[model samples]
Structure formats: C-alpha cells, structure tokens
Target: MKTDKPRVAIQGIRASFHEEAAFRYFGENIETIECNSFKQTFEALKNKEADYVVMAIENSIAGSILPNYSLMMGYSYPVVGEVYVPIQLHLMALPGVRFDDVKYVTSHPIAIRQCIDFFDEYPHLKIVESNDTAACAKRIRDEQLTDTVAIANTLAAQLYGLDVLERRIESNKLNFTRFLILTTHENNKKKGPANKASLCFQVNNEVGALAKVLNVFCHENVNMSKIQSMPVLGKRNEYNFYVDIEWEEAKQFDNSIRQILKYTHNFNILGEYQQYIEDDSPKPQTKPDNTKRYITVKKIE
Candidate 1:
C-alpha cells in the first residue's frame, strides 16, 4: 500500500499559496492533502496521514503569522527545511468579463490588504473577505460569476480558466512568504547537515535576563537571524522567546546552545535545518509583453 511519492499536507485548498509552496518544496510528483487550517495541517502530520507539512511562518509585507508560531510550540513538529515564495497577486474573472464588469473583489484578508493600493482606484468595487485566495477564484469559476473578481496567483487563474483582469496588483512587488518544511522527529534525525536552527525558551522576568542569553550566542559566533517574544498565556509578565540562528560550524552552535540552556528555563530546540537563500538572477519572462516576471518556485526534492 506504500508509495514512493511523499504526501504533503498544506493549510489551504488546491492552488492556494500553501499548495504552491508544498509543490515547490516536495516536487510536483508528491500528493497534496489539503487542510482547512494550519492547526489541521499539523494534525495531519501528527496523526501519520501526511509525510510532511508545509506551513507559512512569515510574509514580507504582512509580518509574521503569530498564530502559526504558537501552533508550532504546541505541536512540536520538527522543521527539516524552508522555502521562500514570491507573492504575486493577480485580479482574475470569467473570460469575457472586463475591468468595469467587476462589481466585487474577493480574496484572503492578507491578500486583500496587500492589493489595497490597486483597489483604491476603483471605489465602486466592493472588497469582500474570503477564507482563501484560491477558494475565491474557484468560487467565481464554479458559480459562473461574471461580475466577481478574485485576487490570487497566476496558478489559480490558469487552473480555473479565468482570464487575468489585472496583473501584479499587490502594493509591493517584492512581497514574499517564507514556509517551513516540517516532519516527524524520527524523520528529522535522518536529514542531512543543517546550518540553521529554530529554538524556543523562557527566561526569568528580570532586567537584562534576555540580553544575557543573546550575548551567549554572540560569544559563540552564532548569527541570530530572528527573535520573537510571545506572552505566556495565564502567566503574568512571562514570555516565550522563539529564535532562529545560523552557524558555519556545528561545534559553535552546540556550545552556544549549552551556554544558553544555563540561563533559560524550559528551553526547546524546535529544529535544525538547511537555510534557504533566494537566487538573484534575471528570470525569463512568461508573457510576450514582459509585463510580469515568473515567480520562481524552487525545488528542494
């Protein structure tokens, strides 16, 4: 009954950004299990229904998805790798529908916010919030809504046979989302060498207590890429610190972790995985007019 292809769980329907990220990380041959929410995505992995899970952790324009951080803590899934996907929002509708025919625009709240600048020009078009961007596009196609447009990626438009009314409608063209590739702890141990690590811990609520922990990383020559603090529920003034660090040598990071453990309480190492670096090169144009550049979806599998 076992197959060679990996079954990846993602927090959205087909053609959603999460699915795009999953395909980018696991390859097109992998089967995707769509979950309605990030919590459900983690559950699929925990229940052994999925080989891996692709979850979005942060976005360049909208900042970190804090809820996902809490979910990671509760689930304790090991992050084995990461991928960065460029977010390019496009307005699409039925084939014959023109720009003026769009009476309402729908998409995920985050996607709607990112394209505010473009929508500002059309005050008559009502903005509607949807559960998922691709879902909005799918709705328009299934219901044959000629007057409704959806803001989503080109993949959604292509898959649903919707014509793009407007291209790259996002306020910022440089917007990108970072997704973490997570797996079971047993599978995580078999991964290759990792240069990056994610950690969580709680420090005593005292002056300079958090700074002291950071100093230990500096002394060990470990580069702290990110640090986030979330208030501990039901506890006053206590916070859980989530940190990501990168190092060139294994011993340096190991020593840093040991020294940091001495000053923190409930220290947890979320995962250690290879860091993703975005490629800086000229991408081929997907259109004849060269109006839109293809969003590079890198493959690690």
Candidate 2:
C-alpha cells in the first residue's frame, strides 16, 4: 500500500521533467522518488513502493521511444495517462565560463544525439554519458568542475545553480517529450476523455497481412496515429507491431477487436490514453477536437 504521501517514482532527480510530470499529475502534496532506470520504475510499482511511474515514451526529434515500448510490454503495466512536456535544451556550466571553454560534455545519450549539431562543431571535446540530462547538471554543480559542461534545461540549471552557457542547444527547437504515466490497472476508465489508444499485434507471414490490419481501422473509420515494427525477442521468423490509434473504438467494444483479430494471431489493447504534450501546441479546449494533425515521424536518415 502507498503511504499517505503518495509516492511517485520517476527516472531521475527532482528537477528532471519526469519528476516534473509526476508533480504535475500527482500534485505538490505527493512525494517523489527517483529510480535509476525505466525498468526500476516498474519494479517499484510492482513492489508497491510507488503509486505511479512517469517516464518519457517519445520525443519530437528522436521519434518513437522504441526502448520503452519493450518495457511497457515486459512490465505488463497499464499505460494509465500521458503527460506531454515541451523539452527545452540548454547548455550549462560553472560560473563565468563561456561556451568556447567547454572542454567536455556530459548528458543523456538521446540528449547528446539531439544536440549533435552543437557538439559536432566542438569535436575536440569529450562527451560523457549520464543517466538523465538533469542529473548531468547536478553532477557539474556537485563536482564543481569548471571545465566540464552539461546539456540540460533551464529548470536543471536553476535547481543546480549552474550557468546557462548556451540556451536551446537542441538541433531543433520543435523538440518535445511524451511521457506515459503507468499503473497496474488495465482499464482506461478515467474522469475525462481519452483521445488516443495504443495497440500491439503480430501477424503471420502472408501476402496481405498488414493490409488486413490496416483495413480493420480503415473500415471502422478509426484513424491510426503511429505504427512501428520490432523484431520478436527469441523468434527469428516473427515480428511484432506496436501501434497507436484514435480512441473512438473503445465505445464499439467487440466490434473493434473482432475486426482486428481476423488477420493477427494475437493483439493487445495497450490503453486509451491522451497526448498531453506537443511542441508549440495549445491544449485542446473542447471535446472531439480532432482537427490537429498527427505528428508525422519522418524516416530517420
């Protein structure tokens, strides 16, 4: 049982966006705990040490959080709610140092990759990996290293009392991170509307297997948002598909899964969740505001 404080386990320190998302969802009264990895968050929830787990699943620049997709499947936890955070990237360092003096950098791998443009120019500097971006800021502050730098946000810089060497170091300013708040419950029942539903499936080798799966949503006029294929863990001949679809199908019940089960051997309804974060986008003000376009993920070069 959760304590009276309602602990929420996030994958980083207090100023990390996952922690921010936890605070936003659970409120100020709830206590926040830190885990070293996404897998750890699941264990905390299972052990009843945390009431909820908040972690990012996708980013505007990095594309689908393919790793977390596997975590979601393995943990078998419900994708309870989604928190969208406009990720702001900034470079921070010890006081009075300029960007030119940044001899080394430490940050999350994904964050380093996202800010490749800036670092590529400074190829002479060594890049170190940290578990999270904000943690890197904490390291720079706690270690009190003058030559070392960290790539994070203003939030981390402020929390750790580091100087912003450069603001907005991300390759693209349109970057945003989508976080999933996971729980043990499988149902999508909530106090509000759910705009999106995630599903997973695997198909037998056939000429029109994918087309049949597409037809399931097409026939029902349910728009699909994202679809990705991953190799099945221990099977060389099979592949698994992870997909997100518009959430209108839940009201249709058996009518929906019956159509989907026609071609796929196994299918799972991940959950009917909502997208709460997007870059430069305002929160929907009314019910059924389907006017916004699905964020198209271009093929990674």
Candidate 3:
C-alpha cells in the first residue's frame, strides 16, 4: 500500500481553507486525508494514517484558536513549518441564480463572522452555519438548492460548478489564517534552515519572574515574535508560557534559550523551523463599510 505521494491530514474536506493551506505548504501532489475535527487530524497522524497535519493556529480577524494551542501542547507534535492562507471568501450559487434569488447564505461559523458587515447590508438573507465552507458549496450543488448560496473560496466554486455572485466578500481583504505544519517526526528531513524556535515553559508567580525571562531574550538580541500564556488545567494561578523567538544569528537564539532556562521551569523546545514571512509591506486598513459598493438592495425604511 505504499504510495509515492505524502498523505496530508486536514480538518475539512477538499477545497476547504485547510486543504488550501496544505497545498500551499506541501504542494498539489500530496493526497489530502479529510477529518471531521482538528483532533481527528492529530489522531490520523498518531495512527500512521497521515504523514503530516495542517492545523490552523490563528487568524488575522478571529485572533488565536485557543483549543488548537491546547491540542498542540497535548500531542507534543513537532511543527515543521507554517503557511498563511488568505481567506478570500466568495458568494456562489447555481449557474443561473442571481443575488436577488438567494434566500439563505451558508458557510462555516468563523467564515460567517468574517463577513458580518456584508450580511448586515442584506438582512433578508438568512444565515446558516455549516461545518465547512466548501461543504456548504458542495451541498448546494449536490442538492440543487436554487435559493441557497455559499461563502467559500475559488476552489469550491470551480469544483462544485457554481458561479460566483460576488468575490472577496470577506469584510477585510487582508484577513488570513495561519496554519501550522506538524509532523510525527521531530527531525523532519524537509525542514529548512532554522531561524525561528517555539518554546513552552513555566515561570514562578513571583514578581519579575516572567519579565526576567523576557529580559534574557532582550539581552541576547533575540526577537520574540509571539507569546501566549495558557492556564495549567486545574491549577490555580499557574500558567504555561508559549513563546516564539526569531534571530538573525543562531548564537543569539541559543544563548537566549540557555539564559531563559535559568528563569523558567518545565522548559520545552516545541519546534525549531524556518519562519514563514509574508510580504513585509504595510497592510492597508479595511473599513467596516468597505463592502458598500456591493450593496445592491436598499433597506426598507
């Protein structure tokens, strides 16, 4: 049963954003194993059903996915890489359907939230939350739902043969989801040069304990790009600090980690991999009413 292509596990069906993120990281040649939930993706990796798991860690609009953070800590999988997929949601329906013909719009809950402003302009359209964006599109096509439309990506529209009624319907054009590429193998053969490191540790509750560890990063000239604190389950007033540090020189990161260990306990280096840096250009701010041009129907006074 050996195949040449690597099997990637994702939390949703094909054409979903998770699949898009997997394709972005592993290219289009790999086989995608769909799972009903994020936990299932990790289970697939654990059971040898998949070679890697593409899991969403955070989104530009929705902030961090806290449940996923706990899953990562529990599974203790190594994050080999990362990828950011732009959440360019589009409204699509049957080929001959028009905007006025749509009565219900369906998408994932998060996707629905991302386009709240667009929905506000069309109160007549009822919102239905689905498990996956692409699944919504597939359901519309499979069931021939003439009065329903789906909010999904371009891949869904093309795969399901639905015409896009509107493009980039998400409230913010800069909205994106950050997905972590995790694998069972800690020393993944495909890992590139490591400039970024993910670590989790606990510092005492006393004053300046957390600050002292951060000061070590500053003293070593290491850039701490992100820090997240999760409360230790069932423990009072105790937390586990998850930090991501990047460095220009490898020595800076090594020295910082060594120094921080003196100030932090239960220190674990989760992963060391090359950071995925999107364009460094300044992002333009998106207004709440940016989708005004697409407002065709007038509200009843």
Candidate 4:
C-alpha cells in the first residue's frame, strides 16, 4: 500500500500550469495525479489516491478564483504551502508547419482570452476553446493536425514534441497564478517553519465589529497580506471573512489571533505555513540602440 513517490493531485494534466506549480513546490521526482476540476483534486486527496493537492487560488490579471475559495471552506483541508507560477503562453505547432499553414488556434478559454491581442493581428486563424491548454497541444501531436496550433507553455511544447512558433504571446507578460498546497493530514513535516496563516471567521453585523478585529491585528503589528469575504450559504446578511496574516515574530501573530477571537465568531485556522515571498528588486534600465546590429554567430566545427 505504500508508494515510493508522493502522489500529488493537480487540477489539470501533466505539462499544464497546475502540474508546473506542483513541480515547483514538490520536486520533479514526485508523481502527479491529474484531476478534471478543483473539487476532484480534493476528492482524490480524501480518497487516499493522492498525498497532496495543488489548487490555484488567484491570478494577477484575472483575479481570484471565487469557486476555489468556496471549495477550501467546504473541504477544510490544511494548506501546507503555496507557490506562484508565471502564466507564460506560447503558440506551438508541428515541426515545419509555418504560421501561414495554421488555420486555427486552440487552448483553454482563459488562456485564449489572455492572448487575444496577439490573435487580433492574425484574424485569419479561428479561435477554439478547450478545457486544458496542454491537452490542446497533446491533441495536435496525437492527431497530427497541421492546421491547428496550441497556446500553452514551454513544458507542453517539450512534452508534446511541438515547436514554439511564437513565444510569450500573452497580452500581460507579468501575469502569474498563486497556487495553494493542500493535504489531508493536519501536520506535514516537509513544510518548514510557519510565518503566515490562513484563517476564516465571522463577525456580527453590528457597526465596528469587523474593525475591532482589524484593529487587533494592526496593534499587534501583524501584516495582513490578503483578506476575502464570502457570503454564508442560505444565510442572508452573513459572511465569512478569510484572512492571511504574516508577522516578524510568532508572538505577534499568536497575540493577534487571541485578541481577535473576542470580537469574532466561528473562527477557524485554515493553515499556518511559511509564506513564499518573491524578489521585487528593480532591474537597471537600458536604452534601445537601433544603430547597433545584434546577431547570433554560428561556429563551424
């Protein structure tokens, strides 16, 4: 009943962004179980088919995935860690197939939408919507469709043996998606020291009720990285506030949680794990010189 590698469930197939996120969090040595939907990922974990679930929670351009928030609250799985994946889309086709030979482009609806600006220049190519971006590339390889192109990532291009005709075709190059690592076990030894925590609680509708909790966190010097509110099902005028907080010292976060409990109800700690911080250092600016010629020189053997 024991396997050598951990089976991580992802919302999409291998070579998709979800699988890439999993590879980022857990090393590439692990096994990935593909799921059709976010809910199915949770079910896989619950059914013992997978050891972990990598689910996307938000995106830089498209915004939060509201349904995932609902799924998290419904399943109550502990988030062990998180990772951010840059959504770099590329146009790929069979080798030797020129852009003029392509008559159609296919990808996920969201992926297709992100590359609308690039597709606008080529109005001759018909746009097709599919459930997964990598699947489109896989189909092109399996069916040998010379007229169809797939919008996917470099991983897909390599996995499906396709050539990238166009690189970084997404409208917003800085786009990225934040994925949460969830597990059925409450404690994961692999997760390092905790600095950030995810929580969900409800406060009375009375005035200053929510402010009181925020004030507690502010007084404790705990930085609130993110906060979201979702309406309680079948309950009018009631909402659950989900918050993510970070701190310099553990005491700061601990004190804030204790003080906020007095002003909130139905408080729940979803997860407490180390926060992944991205480097935001600015790069040096350079001026474009049209006078300079840039070319790759090939060396003869």
Question: What overall lDDT goes with each candidate model?
Answer: 0.86, 0.76, 0.85, 0.85
Residue-wise C-alpha lDDT for candidate 3, range 43-98, written one tens digit per residue: 88887778888999899899888899889889999988888988899999999998
Residue pairs that clash (backbone atoms under 3 angstroms), model 2: 84-277
TM-score against native, each model: 0.91, 0.83, 0.91, 0.90
lDDT of 1 by residue, 1-301 (tens): 3367787888777788998887667656666777778888787788777878899999998889999999998998888999999999999999999887779999999999999999898899999998999899999999999889999997788778899978999999999999999999876743578899999999998999999999999999999999989999999999999999999999999999889888999999999898887657764433222222122222222
Of candidate 4, the 10-residue stretch with the lowest lDDT total is: 292-301
List runs of model 1 lying over 4 Å from the truth: 189-191, 279-301
Ranked by TM-score, the better of candidates 1 and 2 is 1
Q: Residue-pair clashes per candidate, as listed?
A: 0, 1, 0, 0
Candidate 4 per-residue lDDT, tens place, 1-301, comes to 5367778888777689998888777767677787778888888777777888899999998888889988888888888889998899999999999999889999999999899999999999899999999999999999999999999998888888899999999999899999999898643654667999999999999999999999998899999989999899999999999899998899998899889989999999989889987647653333222332211112212
Ranking by TM-score: 1, 3, 4, 2
Q: Determine which window of 10 residues in candidate 3 has minimal summed lDDT.
A: 291-300
Which candidate leads the pack in TM-score? Answer: 1
Which residues of candidate 4, in runs, are more than 4 Å off? 278-301
Positional deviation of 274 in candidate 2, in angstroms? Answer: 3.2
